[model samples]
Target: MSGCCGPAPDGRYSEIFDERFASSIARRYRRRGLTAPEGRIIEALSGLGLHGRSVLEVGGGVGELQLELLARGAAETVNLELSDAYEQQADELMRASGVDGRVTRIVGVDLAAASDADVARADYVLLHRVICCYPDFAGLLGAAADHARSAVVFSHPARNLFTRAVVAMSNARMAIVGHDYRGFVHSPEAMLGVLRAHGLALRTYERSKRWHIAVAVREPAGVRTAPAG
Candidate 1:
């Protein structure tokens, strides 16, 4: 997710994501595919064709993932973003890929608070690197599950001592700068529980040194229940 800081709630995230990371992240995407953990996420979803399916990418950073999904046969894709700095660069990338019109970008909205009527449930929902960006893990995960017609996939910082230490340092910097933007290292089991409450079952799990990937699928009506650990 691209973070921002121009007078919006948690705008500091936008500032950090845009001014500090968007350009470099965009450049990396243009040269390669997604970064390691994100690449793993793409691999998981690529096998699932989007034919006539609606896809929503929450906190889509440079807008690369949505295009990839669209090109793979997704009917239409929507991006809910927090920052505008990535707008121009993302637009350029979309144009260059010839998928400029395939996406709908909504800026400055909190997807966690998004209503079902406001944002229709999608066949697939992605939150690549988004969890660490949000303060409320359960709300965000639950909302993503509710908004997903079939599956919801997300990337978050791996929960561990080292990761916690790093996040603590990052939060300290944000505080020192007087920014409300902060990072979190949430428990994977608790996050899974939130999705379970929303009727999604954990289906796939993968992890790297810094990031972890999890996919939750909306179960069949009669068989709706989370898998036992």
Candidate 2:
């Protein structure tokens, strides 16, 4: 069961995703001018105590999180991106970071197509503002669970009255600007259900204005327990 936004036709979306977004992402992070929402995501993951662990960053736009994770002592960081342009930029950033050996950039691919063995190599998986774009939340969670040995952390727009209003306004604005809207809005309850069905237990979560962020641990099936002794 692949998601509606499964593979973006040709394993890449550079042609569709506005070049301005990529440029904006690079400029903001490079100049240390990330927006409040972006900064919050970085802070949230930083607080996850991820030292000496392997991390896989899905849809890692410009490799900002990967770079930060490496600086925070992650053993290795793998960035899976769906844009060749971003991948090239990420490679350049990794080279400039002097931590090239600690980072691997995989571009022009979707996470769903990755083999279970390849996905299972990570100790932690990060999906920042990426899940909402996925049409099949269930499949996405299942894939994340198969890969993550310990945890999968994600952040997305919260589906509240206020946030819904914001999204509507944003969509209208995008339409006025001649850009196609590309956000998938869902409530936190729906998000949690997806995780639960995939065998992930929520460990911590937080909500801010329109954003809902959570960290979940993977729970394997069929562990025998002694009778309440």
Against the true structure, candidate 1 reaches a TM-score of: 0.91
Give the clash count for model 2: 0
Q: Which number leads on lDDT?
A: 1
C-alpha lDDT (0 to 100) for residue 153 of candidate 2:
88
lDDT of each candidate versus the true structure: 0.79, 0.70
Using all chains and alpha carbons, the TM-scores for the candidates as numbered come to 0.91, 0.79
Clashes of 1: 8
Q: Residue-pair clashes per candidate, as listed?
A: 8, 0
Mark the regions of model 2 whose C-alpha exceeds 4 Å error after superposition: 1-12, 16-18, 33-48, 117-120, 165-181, 220-229
Candidate 1, residue 164: how far the Cα is off, in Å: 0.4
The true-versus-predicted C-alpha distance at residue 130 of model 1, in Å, is 0.5
Best by TM-score: 1
